[model samples]
Target: MAEGRSIAERLSGAMERRDEAPNIALAEEIGASGDKAAVGELVELVRIGTARQRNDAMKVLYEIGARNPDLIGGYCPVFLEALGSRTNRQVWGAMQVLDSVAELRADEIAAELPRIIEAADRGSVIAKDRCTSLLTKLARSGYAEKAVPILVERLKTAAPNQFPTYAEQTASVVRPAEKPGLIETIRKRLETITQRAKRERMEKLLRKLNG
Candidate 1:
């Protein structure tokens, strides 16, 4: 006999169970839902369910966003609203979803950039990671006029552990016109980056950009 219900069935059931911990496989199951109306169910959960349910639902929605962002791209507002959840999980989790859908929904997100930055600053390191990444994604997708400077400013003050990873992605998005300003911004911070590991990473990135 089969050991359990189908993933979709289990996820559907899990969505209604507000008192219990969410099913770990819910995100994967949401992806397996063929990018359909089942997404609305996940959206509803994120909008009104308990905190654990909302967190899991956000995870499921972002899983869908990651696999086919167009599936959940229109729900950008839902994720944006959850940024204020009392729980940090929903807050940063929403940011992560926005990050996954940033390029796909850049027009919708462009106006919300400041709120995104504000949420990240008030939330956690995870929130900052995804928020900065979304800003870079928008800059890459053509909001460079308004987006690149914010990305550069964030890079200037990012924690040491972040310089290597986040800067790598941000570097790839710097347009030729923006490169000079970005390089100068990073170089100005180099004299202040006291961490050897982070300083080395910034130097390496600058070499590639300067070259």
Candidate 2:
């Protein structure tokens, strides 16, 4: 970062670096400094920069969001639009940012559930993971009536390796009326989970939920 270079100019995209350390460091710096101006530049790069640059920009945006979601809450629409991006990195990165701010922007996010669900259904594992996190946040933030059923459906078909964690997260916000369905879902999936540790986790969750 040159003394006089703009924050955008100091990003990994402008520097043309291949590694992510610089981008991560820049994200940390911008997050710590609470530089709202850099967010606009990063969002622009995410929208129009080359693939590498877009990835770096998205990374920085989400990193900043992770530290203080309120700073990036207003950009929920940008993240939602990125769900339609053909780039897998951008799609998942957008999902990650959305997850970070989902609680703060729950109502806005709840309204975009269709697009969010569509992206998660076809996107990368990371995208799916973040989507689960996003939905969980929405459920916890008082949209459980709308988010939990969808979350339960996702849990039913979630990748076996990822099911336990998703189930655990969903459990936290499950309403009493939804618990039976969740218990049934977990019980049915338990047989297919070959890992003993994961099975025990699901079983424990079942026990906790049942009680």
Candidate 3:
């Protein structure tokens, strides 16, 4: 609130606020302004701030990325580094940012597939969800040959509640040669999916793929 207070000082952690509304409002403000300097400060905060500070910084960064990914596109390294963080919030927040910019920075993301996949394998549901989204985006952005197989692997092992959505998302990008394999994976999983809606959705996907 004081004049000349740095962006870091204004963050929720720095201000010692328990609520995230201020942080969300700040993210919207910074995102709308397209202030690269603020983005730089936020990135630095993610690197060296306290646990709460790091969380707030990541929240703001991803919110900015969501509004205008190009504004955060060049910070792929920062995001990648956050994947290795001890803090779960930082990891998932970074994944959200990476997902937002995956298509815009496809080459950079393609080069970091191993790290991304590793993070997804050990990460929370939100992190895995975003990784799935990132892979699908890459699959559509000329990396289908490399991304589709990984996507299929993820689909096979996805949580039953999430399988139908993952299957639906992967369906559009699958090549003809991949269809039968996907269909088979879906069919095998169908028995485990007790929810009528989900089973029906996967069955629908199978029908579409079969035609």
Candidate 4:
């Protein structure tokens, strides 16, 4: 007595529903699919679907990446485009998805060099750090020269004043299990940078003025 269709069939029917809940359900089923057909559907979900639906699709795609390495590579552009909108939680989710995707599809997404560079240069520290880590992984995987320029540019653009605030905020939000040494580590790292290095240094001095 079959109470429901197989995951693939249910996913196919769900894809036609146009509702967010069905789209999300389809994403879940696709994760279960791990079959070749799920790749295109997952890509569309990330590209044009609702944010929740995109996150779900990204999760499935990341799971698929475990077996079909190229599944994530095919959507790097869409992932990067989503990341450009920093205010969206979906953007952050996309980044996490990209990290997994890059781990699996390292060679294929090498073409994302420019976006990777820009990401390291201008995004929030957490964002830049994640981009830096991905580029570092890419380097270790055999693109050292390609990743170096991006890393160097990122270091060059990072502001000294922003580092203190970044350290403080990071310390406050970091999990209690991590707070003991993480705050000190971030503070020490930020303190070593030259204040004259960036315009944001003035912000740090202003703090002294108010103090």
Which residue segments of model 2 deviate by more than 4 Å?
A: none
Give the Cα-based TM-score of candidate 3 against the true structure.
Answer: 0.96
The regions of model 1 sitting more than 4 angstroms off are: 1-24
Each model's number of backbone clashes? 0, 0, 0, 0
Q: Candidate 1 has what TM-score?
A: 0.82
Cα lDDT tens digits, model 1, 1-211, are 0235443345534557643234445555556656466688778878887665566667677767777777788888988898877789888889988999999899989999888888988888999998888988898888987887777777777876776676777788777777887788778877877888888888999999988
> Whose TM-score is greatest here?
3
Instruction: List, residue by residue over 129-201, the lDDT tens digit for candidate 3.
Output: 9999999999999999989888888888999878888898889889877878888899999988888888788
Q: Once model 2 is optimally superposed onto the true structure by TM-score, how far is the C-alpha of residue 71 displaced, in angstroms? A: 1.4
Q: Candidate 3: where is the Cα deviation over 4 Å?
A: 1-3
Tens digit of per-residue lDDT, candidate 2, span 1-211? 3368876677776787777778788888878877788888888888888777788889989889889787888988889999999989989999999999998988999999999999998999999999999998999899999999988888989999899999999999898888889999999999898898998998899999988
lDDT of 2: 0.88
**Residue 142 miss distance in model 1 (angstroms):** 1.4
Go through the candidates in order and give each one's C-alpha lDDT. 0.77, 0.88, 0.88, 0.54
Q: TM-score per candidate, in order?
A: 0.82, 0.95, 0.96, 0.51
Give model 1 RMSD, 1 decimal. Answer: 4.0
In model 3, state the lDDT of residue 64.
Answer: 87
Model 4: per-residue Cα lDDT over 123-150, one tens digit each: 5655555565566566566665565444
